[model samples]
Target: MSSLSPTSPPPAQSHALLSYPSPSILLVTLNRPLAMNALPFQAHWDLSELWSWFDDSPTLLVAILTGAGSAFCAGQDLKEVQANRLQPPSQPYLKGRPPSGFGGMSQRKGRKPIIAAVNGVAFGGGFEMCLNCDIVIASPRAQFALPEARRGLYASAGGLPRLVHGAGIQIASEIALTGRSISAEEGIRWLFVNRISKSQETLLEEAITLGREIARLSPDAVIATRGGLRDAHEMAGLEETWARTKERYEKKLYGAPNMLEGLAAFMGKREPKWVVSNL
Candidate 1:
């Protein structure tokens, strides 16, 4: 894909390193490697702001999230939580993370897609975030676990239900209750992980390739198609979700400029130029 025009970009942040690896792809690397990329309370808000910008940014279509070192994310920072226990109840730290859940992902239904390039350990809250992401590409060394139960904390960040949806009740229960570590191979077996790369060296490259495939298509179509898929996964019934998806995207997508361009390009046997999606 060709480079795109820049829009108002995200501001600098303390816990994250954000860069545009490609014109349509936003790469966010968790910078707290010493802490195993553990998200303290405030990092949640910081990332929430970033993700909001990515969703709204006309130049960006996909986001790739990975950790700086060998851990994608260790989940929430327990030490910070423990320290906050000593603070006064009136303090803001006591209020907990925003309604978006851990790292603004565990419970997010964002507009754009986020692909998790699982480079290493994804434990607790880290694993939770992956459960909600649109795609997950794991490294050979990648391991996922819901060890929060063993730590006297349930995987309360929406991972439990989503796990059951992907891995079934018995499997989800066994993993959650035992807190056993699941390797990348086993993750694919349980149908949680999309696939593992050949090695850690090529993990990010593989993820970016897949992101580009999505980015190359009509932006409006991709958004609406993704929304429909998510609705089927998260909403009530098949018919109801289909009806809702039609009402939400059918007219707008079929009538958009890109819609005409796509059809004309197809008939003319040429490449279609997509406009920034307003959907």
Candidate 2:
């Protein structure tokens, strides 16, 4: 699932390799392995557009973000950072990551779900991307860290806040402030990783299986459910989050054909035939 030979079909856009492993699945492989998949600023904007396309695409319900080689991502290319320091970009948009943050994963509140399949090293912006994903399935060899502090930088791409939101302030402080690398098994303990794969060889397959499970559900239900879950983490006040979730998806979901189809499928004792989400 990771290899992208020159013989492979052209990438959907830039800075990554895209493949439709399944009708509902998008497998996005970060191909900059020589640099341990470290992404430059422009790469972030390219990825933002790619995710926007995925969110707007009716056919893609789930996305899997991985890397071509031994690193998920080492975060922003430090070489790029140093270059920017030496010779800053003349234009505003060229200076840093887009609003979607690093690789369009961190700070992303997209309509569909993204599953982080951490194959190897995930540091800095890489870890930030994992923090925001709905689910993270990691390889046994996978490693995560927020090493920005070691570089005299903090996780400005939204990792720190989301880390605290996910695993409490203590865990967040320990991970971010210490600049230590955590293993995939430890990630499970910290509640950052959903599961660890049997081995690195099987990581993508395991992720695909999980994504398919979600893809088989009512698309509208999935979107609404994801909205509710994200709201719990991103919004304040229980009652306010609850009310906002209802207001956001209720009317559309209640009237959607997928809603009716799901119930009918249950009553009839058959698998639901889902359509793309219009929610």
Q: Who wins the TM-score comparison?
A: 1
Give the alpha carbon lDDT tens digit for every residue of 144-183 in model 2. Answer: 9999899898999999888998889998999999999999
After superposition, the stretches of candidate 1 with alpha carbons farther than 4 Å from their true spots are: 1-5, 88-95
Residue pairs with backbone overlap in model 1: none
- Candidate 1 clash total? 0
In model 2, residue pairs whose N, Cα or C atoms come closer than 3 Å (at least 3 residues apart or on different chains), thus clashing, are none
How many angstroms is residue 173 displaced in model 2 relative to the true structure, after the best TM-score fit? 1.4
Q: Rate the local accuracy (lDDT) of all candidates.
A: 0.89, 0.88
Cα lDDT, model 2, residue 74: 90
